[model samples]
Target chain A: MKRAELIFQSIALITLAVAFILFWNFGKGVSFAENGLPSGPTVTDSYVVLQENLNRMIPILLGSILLSVAIAFYLEEYLARTGWKYQIIARQIIILASIPSLLYGLLGLYFFVFQSKKGSFFIHALTVVLLVMPRTIQSTQMAIRSVDISIREAAFALGAKRWRVIIDHVFPHAFSVIMSGIFTVISRALAIAALIIVVYVWTKHTLQSGDTFYIPGSAIVLLLSSLLSSVLSSFLEAKTNWD
Target chain B: MQSQKTDPILHIHDLNVWYGKSQILKNLTFDVLPRQVTAFIGPSNSGKTTLVRCLNRLNDLNVNFRYTGKILYKDENLYAPQLKAAKIAQQIGMVFQKPIPFRKSIYENVAYSARLRGIKQSDQLDTIVEESLRKAQLWDEVYKHLHTSSDALSNGQQQRLCIARALAGDPEILIFDEPCEQLDAAETPKLEAIVQNLKSHYTLIFVTNKRRQAARVSDVAGFLYNGELVEFGQTEQIFTNPIDKRTENYVTGRL
Candidate 1:
């Protein structure tokens, strides 16, 4: 395999392993038994935690992915145009990509948990949304940057407008790369979502349920969903969009 | 298609281009005659590419690209606010040094521009595709596989496909920017024959650094050096007995 593919798969595998561990820890923490299990009702207890974790993270993950892609599209176009403003916007994207997700958790703690009602879904989801955007923007930038000048010139020489050239030629070619980036961001979202949920649960002192061990199954779901979405989006885009 | 003598196909007057503060073209003035091959020959970095881009407003894609001049096509200033770049490009088709097939079928590659103008009927599109491919001298090779991906063709075939794509648009003028740069020894002659046959119907511009190619293909040639037009006249005169000392020096390999 190529080096880039190797690295992509390696990072994906490592993250999947880490996600599994995080979920397992959550499962153990929430269990009513001595060893990450319920005393008399294992199935019921596991189901409840599963439901709770799904309810908390799924909406945030899906919503943020959509929002991030939208923002990335606009930002990519802005950066693709020839202007001095590109450097400034690009620097901002760099700062955003480098920012730690933990900072978002801290912000979520103070603003979403403390300022507003404690442990609200909207606030937590919003925090994850904010976190997902930067990398998505960066991914979009990289994809747009990869667009060959010859492809664009061919379209332009044939009398395509700036928007038409982007929508027709630029976007389809970038779609595969952008979809991979989105998957990476989605996986990152799963990690961030897990981190935020822990912070929220610990602060709220909800120790009655076996919700702590729910992270493993959730991570598996995230990994599968990431793969599924990547394949689906790319297949659909390549089919419908490209000439 | 042209009837007026005073109205040349294209007129360039005092064109200057700058990329971020560095000037690339300087005070260039020239006229492109109708139904003739006009060659622009210059050493690398002499702004040959930049000059052709000005004709169809392709340089507008450059972020820091700024220019001062007027390029009049068919007596209309191409830079006029009322005129869109798309409108200019529709009439002026360009083929790049590298042939780029749109990752589509051979037929679709030729029909791309026609479809942009809303030509949807497959029959009509087929006719356009066949005519264009015949004109580019590519029909005999790839006619059986028009439905297959264009990427499968050889570099020479791809260049011809690009010419067919340009021709499909029904453009009045066709500009070739070093179309032979990527072709092999055998493929160059294939393209040369097509170009030689094309000037009877279209105002063609050939931008190349090769003096031999210009002498073989162009009716008239312009030599640009350091962003300035050194000489512009009949290809025979410019190649055999150039009046300008710089042109003579550059042609004879002294400079």
Candidate 2:
């Protein structure tokens, strides 16, 4: 590994270890005295909160990745190749990505929760997908575009079809860059619970005051996942390096 | 070889190519004889690359690219509405100015073309890979490191590996678009030798600006000046005898 990469891994490891320790010691229940000493164990659904967050976050993260990557591929490979105005589309995506997250929350609340009348879980998850997709699409498009055009031409000259060029050659060349972009999106998706609060409010399931472990528990989970994603993307980037 | 030379493998007739209203190649025509090296020599941006790319339809990827031409391969229309680029590419392969080995192992880089044609048996792939490498004149050096990444190879070896990759597809005709442009003096002769050796098996179209390289390698030579085919004939005649003033000037290094 390079020196910078080793340093980055070390910092990430230290941060994760500290976060884990902090969560383990104080993330069980709300127990405190006037002097801030541990009084006693209290009633807190810490495990339930953790489970609920995972159940909500995983699918949305996966959905965002799948949907955005597909959209980005179509835009770059097909539409862009057919002479579409990609710069305008990319600019529009950047504008959408920069819009406030709460606006997406409200949009989701009005559409999925109000018009469709779906369950809160589905609504919230889909809303998070909507919130994170713009940035992911932008980044994914950049990754796909960053692939060397010569490689694609070389593949085409080898009797491979357009789809084959994309699937077998282009995707592998761009996979590491794509994963790095997706990892950034994943981190964004995990921290987007604040957006879910809008739908949670309407669904009559809001964060309780005494459930103190929920916030810290979610934070540690986010940290750990981000670190894991970093490592995985780095490994993939190394594995796929051709030069 | 004499039997193969009886008929031209590729016939480009009255070809004109344009990209977004800017004409690149204008009214160009030529015949590429089978199992021989036909070199197109020209200055930069004279549409030499464009003409080569038109053979396998690689220019189709450009959205604004437009062309009016009839490219006949073995008496069949290459630009027929039903003939897909993939199908043309299978019979007519291309190597670019820069060597672009796929981001794969040396073995996989060569085998990838075969795998695309659904050659799934490992033993078959190994045999094809070895044969291609040997044909590219690279098997002796790289046979031991078949599974290693192609990144470890020198630029010359990488270019040869690309040749092996193209040959693995069993193309009858191979296009070399400035294959020696990126190679050093030491490496150029090696590639030149490979091209000379390959003429017995595959129809070769070589594009280069180096006049002597063209003189040394081509069986037939065509000079392009501003996308026009100034001359096309035997290499020795084109080099030494009377022809178009432009062709004479180009060959003698005056223009």
Docking class of 2: medium
Give the top-scoring candidate (TM-score).
2
Model 1: per-residue Cα lDDT over A120-223, one tens digit each: 77776777766787788778778877999789999999988878888889989999998999888877766665555554545345544543444344545654
Q: lDDT (CA) for every model shown?
A: 0.80, 0.82
Clashing pairs in 2: none
lDDT of 2 by residue, B183-253 (tens): 88899999999999999899999999999999999999999989898898889899999379988888888
Candidate 2 — what's its lDDT? Answer: 0.82
Alpha carbon RMSD to native, model 2? 8.4
List where candidate 2 sits over 4 angstroms from the true fold: A1-4, A31-53, A81-92, A106-122, A194-243, B1-5
Off by over 4 Å in 1: A1-33, A36-63, A78-88, A202-243, B1-6
Model 2 clashing-pair count: 0
* Top-lDDT candidate index: 2
Distance from true location, Cα of B73 in model 1, Å: 1.0
